[model samples]
Target chain A: MREITYREALREALFEEMRRDDRVFLMGEEVGHYDGAYKVSQGLLAEFGERRVIDTPIAEAGFAGIGIGAAMTGLRPIVEFMSWNFSFVAFDQIISNASKTYSMSGGKIKVPIVFRGPNGAAAQVAAQHSHTVEAFYAHIPGLWVANPSTPRDAKGLLKAAIRMDDPVVFLEGETLYNLKGEVPDASEDEIIPFGKARIAREGKDCTLIAWGAPFHTALAVADRLAKEAGIECDVIDPRTLRPIDETAILESVAKTNRCVIVHETWPYGGPGAEMVDLIQREAFDYLDAPVLRVGSLDVPMPYAKNLESLVLPTPERIETAIRRVTYREER
Target chain B: MSEVKVERWLDDYREMLLIRRFEEESARAYAQGKIGGFLHLYIGQESIAVAAATTIEKGDLVFQTYRDHGTALALGMTPEAAMAELFGKDTGCSRGLGGSMHYFDVENGFYGGWGIVGGHLALAAGAAFRSKYLGEDQVTLCFFGEGATNIGGFHEAMSLAGLWKLPAVFICENNQYAMGTPLSRTSPLSDLSVKAAGYGMVGDRFEGYDVDVVREHLKKAIDRARSGEGPSFLEIETYRFRGHSMSDPGKYRTAEELEERKKKDPILLILGKLRDAGVDEAKIEAIEDEVEERIEAALKHADEAPFPEESLLYETVTVEKF
Candidate 1:
C-alpha cells in the first residue's frame, strides 16, 4: 500500500467521482485555476478542463445554493467552502434549502451535493475564521456530517459521500492534510458508510473519543500517558459527528469504564455535550467515574499563540481529562 | 399599440383570474383556519409572471420568491395542484411537504417559490453558471421582489452573475412595497434597477402592467443572455392588488393609488385588445368557459386530495436513518 497525503486522497476521490459520473463537477472560490486556496484541487483544472473544475467568483452562498439546486435536478456537485469558517455566508442555503429539499419535495428530488472544506481552527486565524461548526450542523436532522482523520478514511468516505443520495457536509481538518497514511485501492464492494466511527488505536484502561484535529492531540497524550503511567487509552475517531459511533463509544466505555471526549469547539454547547449526555445515559452503568470533556475554553478563540493555547484543547488538557476519567490520583 | 389578439389576451386574462380567485379562496380558507403558515399572494401583479414566462425561451429556468403563485401559474403549473398545495394536500406539487411558499417542480425547471428573500437569487445564478459551463444554451431567470435587493447574497449574486458573464435574467417584481415597508421608506435610490449597473450588469425598469412592454424587453434580455451576453436585471414595476398575503388589510398603500393602478389592469386591457383584434365573440366566450371549467376541475381535485401522514414526514430528509 502506497502512502498519500490527506489532500491527495481528497483529490483522488474527486477525480474518481467526476470520471465515474459525467454529471459530477467541482465548484468553489479557487478550485479550478488557482489550484484551491489549500491546493487540494491542484492539477484538477488541467485534466478535467473548466467544465468539471469550476472557478467561482467568490460567491459562496450562490455557488452552494446552485450546487443544491443542481443536485436536485440530477447533477452531482461538490462545492468547497474554501475554509468552512467562510460557510457563514452560505449557511442559510445549506441549512434551509440543501438540507430541506428532499423532504420538502417529498422524495421527488434528491440533493446529492457535497459541501466540503477544511473545518475548525488552523493555528491563529482568529475568531471569525477559527470557529468550529460541526456541532451546529450536526444538530440539524437532515444532513450527514463526515470528518475524516486519515487519508484512507478521507478517500473512502468522500467517495461514499459523493455517491450518496443525500447532502453530506464533508469537513476536513487543517492539521491532518499533510499527515501521511496508506490508502487501499478503491473497489466496487468497498465503501465506508456514514455514522461508522473508526478505532484508530485499541487499548483498555480509558476510552478517548475525538474527531478532526483534536484526535491527534489525544493520540499524542495517550502515547505519553501509556509510557509514563502504564495506562492504555483506546482512541476512537468518530468519523461522522451526527450519528457519532455510539456503538463504538458504548462498547469502549463498557470495557474501560472510563471516557474522555476531546474537541476544539467551545466546551459549552459543543459536540462534547451530546457525547457527555449519551455516555451518561447509555454507558452510565459502565462508568467508574464522571466522563470528562476536554475542549476549547468557553470564549472566542484568541489570536495570540499563548492565549490560543489557553483557549483550545491541548495534550495537557487531554491528559488531564484522561487522568480524571481513570482516577489516576496524579491529577 | 396593443397588438395581442383576443385569443392570446383571453389566455392571459384567464391566468390573472386564476391568480385572483385562488388568492380569494386562500384568504377565505386562512380566515376559517384551514390554510396555516405564511401565505403570500400575487393578486395584482400577475402580468409580470405571465409576461416574463411568455417572453423567455422555451427551456429557460424560472426561480421565484415566496409570493410565487403567479410565477407557477405563468410556467403552466395546473391550478388544481397549486390550490391543493395551499390546502397542504398530498396531491400538491410538493406533496403537502412544501406548503404555501416552498413550491418546487424540478422537472419543469421551476427552481422554487423560495421562502428566503435573497437566498435563492444566488442559487439561480449558480444554475445559470452551470448552464454556461455545460455548454447548454439556456438562461436561469430569477424572480424576487424589491424587498430582496437589500440582502447580502443579492449583492454577491448580482456581482458574480455580472463578472462571470453568466446567462441569468434577474426579474424583480417591484410592487411598491416590501410587506408593510414601502419602497420610499427602505431604499434611498428607490429604483433598484439602477443598482444593477453598480454590479457591472445591465439593469432596466419596465411597466409590469403593460404585458407587451414586459414581453418585448424580456425577449430582448433572453436573446442577449442565450447568445452569451452577461445577465440583465429587470425592475418590473408592478402593484400587488391584495395585502402581502391573504390576510392583509390593504392599509399600507392608499385607495386612490390602487384606483390609479387599476387603470393599468393588464387582464382588462388584454380583453379589450382581443375585442379590437376581430376575434369572434363566441370564441372569446368559449375560451373563458374553458378556463373556468379548468379551475373548477382543479378545485375539485384539491378538495378530494388527502393530507400526508405523519410517518412520511420523518422520511427523505436524509439518505440514512439516524
Candidate 2:
C-alpha cells in the first residue's frame, strides 16, 4: 500500500468510480479545464475527457438542480462546490430535490449523486468563506453526510458513497488535505459500507469521539494526555456522521464511563451536540460525569489570526475537555 | 408516430371533456375543502393538450408545470387514479406524496407536474439525453410557460439540449400573464420560442387555440426529433381559460378580448367540424354519454377511495437498500 494525501485520495476515488462506470461524471464551477479550484481534479481532464468532466458556468442553483435531474435519469454526477459556504447558493437543489427525490417520489427515483468538496473552515479564509455545515446538512433526513479525515478513509468512503443509491454530502476538511495515510489496495469488488467507525487509537481511561479536521486535533491531544497526564483516552473516528456508529460509540462510552466529543463547528447546534444527546440517552447510567464537548467558540469566526485561533478548537482545547470529562483536574 | 388519423377526433373530444369536467369538479372539490394545496385549471386551454398529444408516441415522455390535469387526462392517466391522487389517497400515483400540482405517473410517461417554474425543462432534456444514451428512437416534450423563458434554467436547458443535439421539443405555452405580472413586464422578448434560436435551435411559433396548427407543429417537431434531427422550440401563443389558479381577478385582459379568443375555441371548432363531416347526432350523443359515464365513474372512484394511510408521513424520508 502506498501513502497518499487526503485530497489526492479523493481525486483517485472519483477517477476510479468514473473509470468503472461511464455514467459517473463531474459538474462544477472549475471541475474541467481549471482542474478544480483546489487542484483535487488535477490531471483529470486528460484521463476522463471533457464530456465526463464538465466545467459548468457559475450558475450553482441551475446546474446543481440539473445535476439532480441527470442523476435521476441514470447519470451518477459528482458536483463540486469551491467551498461548503458556496453550497448555500445551491441549497435549494440539494435540500429540496437531491435529498428528497427518492422519498418524495415514494422511492420511485434513486439519485446516486454526490455534492462534495472542502467543507468547514479553509484556514485564514474568514467569515463569509469559513463555515462548517455538517449540522445543517445532517438535520436533513434523506441526505447522508460523510466527513473523512485521512486519505485512506477519504478514498474508501468516497467510493462507497458513489455506489450508494442515495444522495451524499462528502465533506473534506481544507486543513486535512496534506495528511498522509496508507490506502489499502483492495480487490476490485471491495465495498465499504456506511455507519462503521474506525478505531484510531485504543485505550481505557475515557473515550473521545471526533470527526473531520478536529479528529486530528483529538488524536494529538489523546496521545499527549496519555504520555504526560496518564490519561489513556480511546479515540474513535465516526467517519459517516448521518448513520453514526452507535454501537461503537455507546460501547466505548460504557467501558470508559467518560466521553469527550470534539468538532470544528461552533458549539451552538454543532454536530457534537447530537452525539452528546445520543450518548447520554444510550450510555447515561454508565457515565461517571456529564459528557464534555470541544467545539469552536459560539461566535462568528473572526478573520484576524489571534481571534481566529481563539475561536477554533485546538489540541490544547481537546486535551482540557478530556481532563474535565475524566475528572482529572489539570493541577 | 405518424400523423393522427381523423378518427382520433372522437378521442380528442373525449380527452377535452375529461380535462374540462375534472377541473370543474376540482374547483368544486377545492371549495368543499376536499383537496388541499395549489390547483390550476385548464378550462380555456383544453385544445392545447389534446392537439399536442396527437403527435406523441407511447415511448416519448412528457413533463408539465403546475397546470397539468389536462395533459394527464390526455395521456391516459386514468381520472380515477388522478382524482384519487388529488384527494391524497393511497391508490393515487406517487402514493399521495405528490398531491394535485405534484402528480408523478411514470407508467404514463409523465415525469411530474412540478410546482417550480422551469424545473422540468432540464429534466425533459435529461430524458432525451437518456434516450440517446440508450440508442432509443424517442423524444421528450417539456411544457412550460412564457414567464420561465428568461429564467436561468431555461437558457441552461436549451443550451445543453442544443449543444448535445438531443432529441427533445420545448412547448412554450405563452398564456399572456404569469400569475399577476403581465408577460410584457416578465419578459422583454414576449416571443419566447425565438430565444431558442440564439442557442442554434429552430423555433416555430403559432396560435395555441387552433388544434390543427398545434397538431401540425407538434407532429413536425416530433418527427424531426425521431429522425435524428435536433430539438425544436414550439411557442404556442395562447391565453388562460380561467384566472390563473382560481385566485386572480379577471381584470388582466378585457372580456371583449376573451370573447374574441373564445370565438376561435378549438373544442367548439372540432364539434363544428364533426357536424360538417357528417358525424350524425346519435354518434355525437353517444360520445358525450361515454365521456359522462367515464367522468361519473372517476368521481365515484375518487369518493370511494380512502385517504392515504397516516403512516406514509413517517415513511420515504430516506432511501433504503433494495
lDDT agreement with native, every candidate: 0.83, 0.82
Per-residue lDDT of candidate 2, residues B26-101 (tens digit): 8888888888888888887888888767778887888888888888788778888888888877877767787787
Q: Which stretches of candidate 2 lie over 4 Å from their true place?
A: A186-189, A299-301, B1-5, B223-229, B246-261, B310-315
State the weakest 10-residue window (summed lDDT) of model 2 chain A: A184-193
Quote the positional error of residue B223 for candidate 1 in Å: 1.7
What stretches of model 1 exceed 4 Å from their correct place? A186-190, B1-4, B278-289, B320-322
Summing lDDT over every window of 10 consecutive residues in candidate 2 chain B, give the lowest-scoring window: B1-10
Q: After superposition, how far is residue B172 of candidate 1 from its true place, in Å?
A: 1.0
DockQ of 2: 0.43
lDDT digits (tens) for residues A1-331 of candidate 2: 7788888888888888888998888878888899889889888888988878878776667567767777877778788888889888778678877777676565677788899989888668789898988988988888998999889889998999898878999999988888898887645534566789989998898999999988888898899889998999889999988888899999999889999998888778767888888888888899998898888888887899988988888877887778888888878
Residue B173 shift from truth in candidate 1, angstroms: 0.8
Can you write out model 1's per-residue Cα lDDT over A1-331, one digit (the tens) per residue? 8899999989889888888888889989988889999999998899899878888877788788778867765688999989898898899999998888788777677788899999988888888889788987888878988988888889989998999888999999977889899887756424678888899888899999988888888988888889999999999998988778789889998999998899887778778899989999998788899988898898888899999888888788788778877878582
